[model samples]
Target: MSAASLPGVRLWTGRVLEDLRAGRSCLCLLPRTPAGGADAAAVLDELLHELGDFVLLPAPGPADAAAPRGAGLPGPPAAAAPPPGGPWTDTAPVLDYDDGLSAFGVGPRGGGPVPSDAASAAGRDTPAAHGPAGGGEPGPSAAGRAPERGRPTAHDLADRVLKELGAAAPGADSGPAAGVDGLLHRLTDGSGAASRVVVVRGWHEPVPAAAAELLRRLAAAVKAAGLPPERRPRLLVLAGPSGLAAELPEQVARDDVAVHWWWGVHGRLDTATVVAMARPPAAGRAARHQLLEAVAQATVVEVCGPFLDLAERLAAEWDGSPDTLPPQLRRLLCDEGLLPGVPDPDDAARTVPAPRGPAPGAALPAPAGALREHWDRGLADRWDGRLRHWPGAAARRDPRTQETGAPVWDWEWEHGVRTRIWLAQNTALLPLLDEAREAFTEVIRSRSRLPLPDLAARYGPRRDGVPGPRPGTAAAPGSAAALAGMELGDMWRAHIQGDARLSQPEADRLRTLWRSRNSLSHREALDSPRLEGLADHLTR
Candidate 1:
């Protein structure tokens, strides 16, 4: 797929374009990860081609014999050409502007060759001699010439930049000498119709002291210059890793030089976009949505390149089935911790079942009645008051459309508040609620004059003031003997408040706990202050 179509690439490129158009220079840092390196490079190439109309002057490599040419600077050769029968070919055209126009006013704005006298005065060869028609070769004149191969110096960079702008060779026209000042003069001279984009590759390498100083000066000069936004030149430095920004001179920072980082988490692609890219043409919308959600949950970390690679692999083998995920995709999700791994049949059979009630001799009884039913049939069936393999509740039903058709899972809501509440209950609030229940039970047992069994029998779930058995009688299902079966909500409403010893403020404190308990049971969470207050009250 084209890099421009990738969400991360599009976002970064759009921001850079905005900076350039606003006359701000940029320093683009490529991803340090090996997998992302190729993706960053592809995006850079795409951006360069996309800005074809701009004066794109790639800084010359150290080995070039002649000065850099306009729209034809060869920074480096491709590592290898695509194979003839490969799935893709490398036939994309290079960025080449019309050569008839000179960088200065030697030719008409429409189009014409540079005047012979003007070309010679500037020490420039005819446009044809500078490079081939398509910006491919150095032409016959430069073919046999060889230059020292090492990092280009600050002077070398400045000279080429000035020449590309059609400024006379440094010191030729009594202009500023070939250096940062001279280059700035030409760029801010207000001569060219198009903005200049000077893209310097291989910036991850140690920059020469002179080159670094030159860059600082150019950045400062561009900012200080009051040229219109469209007329200001932009400098884009491309590097492989990060931390290089610190090495740059402080002037670059002071001027607010835009730094675009494409690495690590910063480079992650949108999950939906990646899924779309990897989806088979024949896949149904439901299949696409499912895959998108699975990927979003699976990729909790920033690893866009590897994730995209896996998605492509899945696409190649996908059968376009909508009912279930492809086997390979399922295994991938399992490995990513999104789905549960395959369980051994013997282990599954031997696995202990979840506890259905409080342990024997506990301070309080397990919940009964509506609260018990809710715990078993509601919370347990959904999230079990804990986030397990999926870390999310089942897809929620949309109330608005439930009457018209079979309920459909609202994936959006599932990913939103539902997931958040589930996380809070499992991680922060549920443990405190459990503690509050035990504390409330102890307080009641210690403070009240009435026996716990009699209190429960009088106030706990039963029919219309009709007592089953006296406190000392044999315990029946609905008798006071079942005090242990009442949960915090039932005990608070049915028993705790019935005790006259509980002061109004104390009763109110217990009420707070009851409300919080209900909120959690209904899939909501108390705010931090309430939770903290609840904990403090329990400790007291």
Candidate 2:
């Protein structure tokens, strides 16, 4: 499937385009994983292709070992020759713009001013004549300047930007170079009628301190420029692994830079969308639905590429067989305890039956498929054979055995199942839980007559408005301060339920949410009924 067609891609790209059109430059953070990186690139490329005028640039590398750190300028050349095809090499220019127009509809060639007639007709001064609204002297155009002999510097970057935009390069005759500030002037000064975009790819790689500093300056300049959306140039930095943002200087990493996650917000794929992508070719609708349910239940992170690979493997191995269970599905069922293991034929023959007429009751539910039939028969025969040899086996074999006494639950099995369910669904569940908590907190703040400050003093961690010890630190077990730090669950139980001003129905609604919140916190997943109830209450 086309990456642009994906729901996540569509949603993310729309926001990115909106940012660009509004004249706000973007910092699109890609996932660090290989598959994630490729997908993110595809998504970004598709958006750039649609928007139509972007220059793709390779990220710069460190100049030399002795290069000054975070200086925001290029260091002197080292004695040894720089590696061939490296960012420093003249053979490979920093900016790639040749295919920008033909293939991706980006990086339009000329940056000359709008025609005189067009400007006069529009009743506005020619952009080149008046210069950019934000005043700054234009630096000597860096046009045709040989790339600095050593490692590429911020100066090289500026020159490349100028060249790609068709602005003049900083030659010896053009006067002192304006560097990045000059590049910004060229971009915003309205020297070009067409919208310009500069994209730095592979930014997830380790960025030199100087380059990082240069990026900070560029972003700061763009933000402070205050040009209209149409006039400002778009700057996009595509980097990875979500955590890469921390490595950026504080200025560039701030809220001013628009960060968009290619993977869903938490690096997890949407369950329903992933299941749909896994649909097997040539399967009946009912069978497909059942298979999707199994896949959805089994998946944890549901990474797009890996899950699709597994699905392809399933299709190849199954080969349209309807009677036998697919090996992949069988493995999933065995792991999830939905299917019983094959029994020993010798044991089945040796043990005698209890001779009691079939115990009158409805049979247990099983998944649909021929494999399920085989499993049911094997299970029944195994139990029947053991019944006569083992005392109380018949009682234990009853599906409704729990009704007669306290159920003998396997704590390990229960824990394993709960853990799997939580892993599969937590991405969706956690956000909903957060929203519900916020809503409930607002209810208490607005409706309850209790004094907010007093409530915090009584139940919050900091009694005197002073910060407490870091979370999970050792504190006196019985101290009032130590026992403080009430979570949503605790707040609902200790205070909301007891509030006289709150009505019973409202309290009950909050109680349901509290239960759901507690279950999730404990790494347990709620069943559909409870999940639905939580959503309904929150929506109301």
Poorest lDDT segment (10 consecutive residues) of candidate 2: 384-393
- In model 1, the runs with Cα more than 4 Å from the true position are 34-38, 49-52, 59-151, 170-173, 203-213, 223-230, 242-245, 249-251, 263-269, 279-307, 310-540
TM value for model 2: 0.41
Model-by-model lDDT, in order? 0.44, 0.44
The C-alpha RMSD of each candidate to the native structure, in angstroms, is 21.0, 24.4
Candidate 2 — which pairs collide? 32-241, 54-107, 141-168, 141-169, 141-170, 142-168, 142-169, 142-170, 143-168, 143-169
Give candidate 2 regions above 4 Å deviation. Answer: 34-38, 58-149, 176-178, 203-211, 223-225, 241-250, 254-256, 262-269, 281-540
lDDT of candidate 2 over 313-400, digit per residue (tens): 3334433221222234444433434343323445442243323322222111111222222222222211111221111111112245
Least lDDT summed over 10 consecutive residues: which range in candidate 1? 87-96
